[model samples]
Target: MVRRHWINLNGMWDYLITDSRILPWQFYKSEYFPFDGQILVPFSPEAPLSQVKRQLLPDETLWYSRTIQLPENCLNTESQRLLLHFGAVDQICSVYINRKFVTYHKGGYLPFTTDITDFITEDLTVSILISVHDFSDTSYHARGKQQLKRGGMFYTAQSGIWQTVWMEIVPNKYIRDVRVTPDWDNSLVRMRIRVSSASSAENASPAHISPTAADQTDSQGTVLAFSPDRQNSSNVICKVYPPVFLEADGLNDTLCQDEITTAAIRPGKGATLSIPENMQKSWTPKEPWLYPYSLEYGKDRILGYFALRKCDVQIADDNYPRFFLNNQPYFQSGVLDQGYWPDGLYTAPSDEALIYDIRAMKDLGFNMLRKHGKIETDRWYFHCDRMGMLVWQDMPNGGSSYHHWFVTYLATLLNWMRIPVKDLHARLLSRTDEFGRQEYIDDIRDMVRTLYNHPSIVTWVPFNEGWGQFSTKKVTDFIHRLDPSRLVDSASGWFDQGCGDINSLHYYFLGLPVPESDRVLALSEFGGYSLRLPEHSACKNIYGYKKFTTSEALTDSFSRLMENTIVPSVKKGYSATVFTQLSDIEEETNGLITYDRKKIKMNPLIVQKWNTKLKKSLHS
Candidate 1:
């Protein structure tokens, strides 16, 4: 149930940076703090728009305050339940409404919901205060590329409220969350939904079962899904609504939820439910097809959709592994998307912005996005689910001391020289970085739980470039145990403990080479070939693999990289390749698009022609 009328708790908020040794003597709802002035919501303090453009020291904690009037309906609801939702809050967040502490959430990225119904009053105002502290890469936490002092590869630091804030109203009994997993092998989709009843006891059973008019999608279709355990029981029968056609108008028209497609339901098992064979649709980047099912469950409702697709790795003729999607081997063309924005930094401005990145890349013939370092907002994964873009999600690296000078030079350099570089390898061999190790484990558990539902996410990468390197086998096993649906890439760049799905490689300031015989080879990072558009560039001190002065040279070099290295090698054995980046990030100029997104460094046709050539080569 998407709420439409609730006020956005985003925008301007009162904030205070304090070294407080004591709690506020008397704090209340909607009350202002000692006004340290206003800040833009959803943008970190370190960002340009966050107003307080200063980084919080490790010892210091940030305080924030804001007041909002409770809506008339919130206080007067028949069920008398009001729910507040925080799309995401960094590190940790303690929430309050009307001067009472209600809940707190830990984890840098992932949504949390709270119940504020019992605390609501007609004349009451909603009050909130939050605190945030981050050490970024300094201390071992999922810091991604954030550092106190930013330079090559690492960008600005971001903190506090970088996601949406909103509220929702629901009846005494309503759906809380739904886990939808689609299985093409059985032509079935699984739904495990939770419902909450406002008046019921804390752990009481839900009010009722069986969905009603409230069960729906934006397409005006009724909701219905199969209950595998009760399949033979015709107790619940459904008729599909209208069909949605989005491609006719292309980018100009918004794609509306056209209809509710219903399926049979059984109680517990997945085998009982069956999807008609003809209705099955395969999802691919070129033709990303998503079928929405407006699921109904006894009056309460939520939107659910799934794509019919299969991804697996199989031994090929050349003895190297190949990636097959929907039974066909397709070479994966990917870009390293940090998922950062100029305005929001770690977060995108809106859901549309996230979808646009995938669509834009798809239009240029790429199929995958290697999410670099950071785990993204769930909405980002939702966009990927409905849009048909494959993802290689990374677990943000955080741990004891990174060997910047030695690791990259000795390990990565010597690997190119075919020399094994090992001092002791993994965190087990190093005793000093205990804090980094524990933090890594904590973040990994949070990552798997948060991103488990998205189908587009096909792989999980735990570490990159030997940053805070630790136990590879243990971490890899943990991720697989959490969700075996997708592939796992244990180590992205260097310090290979000889575990994981793809034998990944990072090739920058170098050339792509044919991989060895055995594992599925992925050129995880390469072709940083760059061209600077002076008018649109961030600055002159930027870096890239090879600097090109002209579009012709850049495009020619890119084409050569594909024709000679990528395309030929893909045909031989390689399954996927990750280009250096999607956009020019701060100091990194080797991006397909300029920093501001105002200019395309290479002509679209040049890229398209080569992509098409590669596609044809793979099929041939």
Candidate 2:
């Protein structure tokens, strides 16, 4: 969701690194802490684009300082409140305004906001300060694929702010959040809009609002006004537009059409709007239709969008369980997207860079992407929604050091021998710490809540390759309760606990085989065929399941794998297959594209041709 009145605070900011023992309050007490350099906002210090070119250690603290002058019209203090928003900060952070501590946040993957209405001076100038600390992979803090040593699968560690920072001015009583759920089978859309109370309580939780009995009607006999169940409820208005087609410039001509429906309600409950059959459009990879809507509450307004689609698993005519999208069997030809960049590390260098990665895969005939072991910026999912791409979101893994002998080497050997392994050994899997396990649960809740509204996400992957895997049934049940709309891959790679909607498998060096199970079958990870271009490679030490000397050899081998193994298995029962990766990351050279994104390592036409063949095999 987005608002019209907001300022993007993304530019250069003064930065300083200090020992973790140094207290943030010391800066308020006239203590001298010199900000030695400037780093780009929304880019971690470890990223090349940040201009710091330094890694923040576990025992160090990264501090940021900036100042902004508010707009002249924003001085209506009695009616308006200023809210500061941070997309994400690594590990943990403390925020301050005008040298006074405001709030503290943990968990780096989700967003946090602070109401800084009282911190602005009379001149409308505000000084902001933020301090961050990241443990990286040194401890159990959900650090996904980030290692201090930084080699092989793990890459460099980054700290401080790694996402956008912004601010917005809103009325005292305003809408805080909006959640949209589409019911394609019923042709209805349900919404829950949370609105703030008139009280000036700082950071108080918003009250939910639902529609009450209709109090008034328009000349067309439509319910245009509704009364609130509670006396303090805010007057809310909703306008839902027809589905629009996205284009190169923006939304196409269909968006200019008159709104299909309008409803007025109050805070504290939910509302459902029915879409007429003629106006209803099912969202799919070939036709990514979206309905734009606006919510007006008191003096606040926000614009958002949603899609009508459904994802499930059902038995097809062949008497085999398969993945279904909108009541039809759909083969998910996907790629493993790590969401890394040569310049920005975790963050993409630009919005266009993120779009390029998604668009490139779609052009190559891939309909889905497994976001491996990391959460991305909201913009990435937004593009996926608008571009008609399916997503499997993985929760970032964190725990003490994993036992390679148990989780990797022995597990792989046992898997090849057709032996099933359970995730009961908490110590070996690095999930023994009670605090760490609770923190992992908290991280899961935050991740789902933050990304629940995205239509592109079809699966929730809790564990990957046995990293910090524990209580598979319990965690899967928790996710199901949180969101029953999507499928769950409780354990992606090694430890299949006989739960979840799919029996997911990973094949690197081993030959591909379709596992016989009552649930859907998915090759979650495979095809690590490497072709390194020296000029575009990030590191000389190459790592992949299969090494190729040239593009022709790699493309030919991939085609053979698809035509012989993948396509045939799809016809039998295989529902989905994810190629090892979208691009090279650090020392891992098993990607269709190079790390710099400057060159393609495989033949694009051959890749697209095989992908089309693989998808068509499900029905053939």
Candidate 3:
């Protein structure tokens, strides 16, 4: 998600929240009105990181206003486009540039953009106004685990902008997008480039440019006609330069960059390019190699990088379905990461804060993390890619209230017997609403498309413990069609349709199961042992599968669990294991590290020793 010519519009903004339910037509006139107060950008109002720490109620509508000045020599005149990008905005969002409506988006977790070149004059500064409406738990939006009434397992709801806001100046005829996939078996790196249209916005109407005071009352909202002026791009030239790598011995290597490949491609249509086998370097957790690339087309040039690797499931020497990376059988010793912060609910405080979690987990000698139930910012996956950590990404769950008697209590009992419920039973799975079900499908596709390039993501979990789960087998096939590059966990914990790359399960109070299925056996969730330190916990409401008193005792229990259950299970066909979690969250005081990120609950050295031994035992 990184680009060369961009501005970070994340700092301060005028904010207001009212239960008045202001209509979009009133926005143009309200721009001149004063806001109630100022709040920090990219942090939800409910989060502590945002200066305005207040709950954004479902009945309230939030508005944000900010002014920005474009720097000199920033926009590419030939490309004739100024792209305004928002990292994310909760639920429904409407964006305006200088009183004129620019664009609108519905999803909460994905990014959106608008081309404002026609509306923006040669003068630098421009006004930006954003409106957001979030109905947490009141509606069937794909909010992860946020609830109106926060408590155990569910957290306080956050709304509005909770991620970075930025603007990128791209050439009118720039490379719109690129998809890179590794063909390790053929020793090649395949790339699909999407080129932007060559048309300019010069003839756009100016009547709506600066709307009159009389025009402000229009209920239909200002209509600014702007769409991608796509051009015939089949004849554009694309140049691919060989990758350059940093040396380990304090010496830089330039030999790799001497080779280059050039080709002609269509700008509007999809075109393919390949890096020769000899020039590619394979990527892995032990040696995370990134091949730096530079792509040039017409008046546009972009610099990016990609890793060469492959993920699959195959029978190993021991006759167990093993997870394979780069055509080699490897064990994914992982921990479940919920990815929530005490100060910043969904958003990390800073980029370094995101890196800290990934680096700390890798330092624990674990290779993978099952990102439980929620999707993280793109930078989180970027860090995992460069820091040599594998990831199992989960699509955030959303649906109606669960039928506790059937979906919760009875489901848990049936899980013990390794039985799966009829996933199509909409009521039991919390997917009774048809609109909510379709929205889930759409969100998963968008999630996959957005995170496809990250090498760290090896598996996609569509259903976890049957929360909002429906149409398991069909959904599994749909995901495979989206991207066959990675494995799919059809059902992570329960309601297993027996369709997917792995036979995934969850166990808390007893020993792990050794399933004799045709698929890879994965203990997706286990070992939620809790040890509450008064100084480190958020509250006295201690919750976990098992409770302990001291760090010493916790470490002792963790070591014994690995030695007696996990290690032997690997030999008995358990290909992957995800310990309950990486860090404590709210009342769930069962993590290797405390929630505030101040203390390591377990002895790092002892945990590291056991983890290393466990990894080595996978091969034995």
Please tell me which predicted candidate would have the highest lDDT against the true structure. Answer: 2
Give the Cα error of residue 209 in candidate 3, in Å.
40
Summarize candidate 1's per-residue lDDT along 113-211 as a digit string, tens digits.
898877655675666767766656566666778877777778877777788887766555556654555666666555544456433332232223333
Q: Which 10 consecutive positions of candidate 1 have the poorest summed lDDT? A: 265-274
lDDT of 3: 0.78
TM-score of each: 0.85, 0.94, 0.89
Which parts of model 2 have CA positions greater than 4 angstroms off? 24-33, 198-233, 247-255
Clashes of 3: 6
lDDT tens digits, residues 1-620, model 3? Answer: 33556788898999988786664555457635658799898999988888999988878889898888787766655555788888789878888787787898888888778887776657766789888899887777888888888777777788999888888777666677666777677665555556566342312222223444533212323321111232233344544555534332211233245545555543333333456767677788888877665666665677666787898998898888899888889889899998889899898988888888888988989999888767788778777887778999999888887566886668767888766578878876778899898989999999898888888899999988888898999999999988889999999887889899989988885445666899999999888999998998887898888999999999999899888887888888888889888888888888889988889899999989988888888776
- Compose the digit string of candidate 2's lDDT tens values, residues 163-214: 9999998988888777677878888776666677734332232232222354
Backbone clashes counted, model 1: 27
Deviation of model 3 at 128, angstroms: 1.1
Give the Cα error of residue 389 in candidate 2, in Å.
0.5
